[model samples]
Target: MSTVSVREFSYNPSAVLARVEKGEAIQVTRHGNVIAILSPAGSPMERYAHLVAQGKIKLKPVTAAERHSMPHYEVPEDVDPVALLLAEREEDDR
Candidate 1:
């Protein structure tokens, strides 16, 4: 999601609308509080096709060998990812 202040939204609505039209979700905020969410009007596939027509998104077909070569990871059951992320964010504040 993307966020824009109420003042910014009022000043340049077209830019924000463009993002929404491209299937991005935008959060409108006022005084640091979220007031509304702007989303694309049509289905996700329809929006994606629109973006493709506008040259905003590109479609490419991956070869079978290419897919086989992709790397994957195995998560350890003992790891709590959310806790690790929160701890990392807290450390960054210092």
Candidate 2:
């Protein structure tokens, strides 16, 4: 765990965030009183693992073939997506 004053947190937020990203907890203090604790956000699977363990949810592991079965689309070379979007917005304003 690491302790950082509120001023230090505000001055160099990225450094503090880097510490948190490494699985280290950070304590933010203001006026010598603890204010908040910063921790890394767990992966989606980790977040739901507890639910699965408690029998509240069932999860099926996806096979490699199943993963690649979803439909895929390719944009054409002549298409100008930004221009199309701007034209659509202009139409909506009329």
Q: Which pairs clash (backbone N, Cα, C closer than 3 Å) in model 1?
A: none
lDDT by residue for model 1 (1-94), tens: 5779999999999999998988887767788766666767764344455454344665455699997997554537798856877877899999
Query: What are the Cα lDDT values of the candidates?
Result: 0.71, 0.70
Off by over 4 Å in 1: 43-94
lDDT of 2 by residue, 37-63 (tens): 676787445555445445576556568
Q: Give residue 39's lDDT in candidate 1 (0 to 100).
A: 67
Scored by lDDT, model 1 comes in at: 0.71
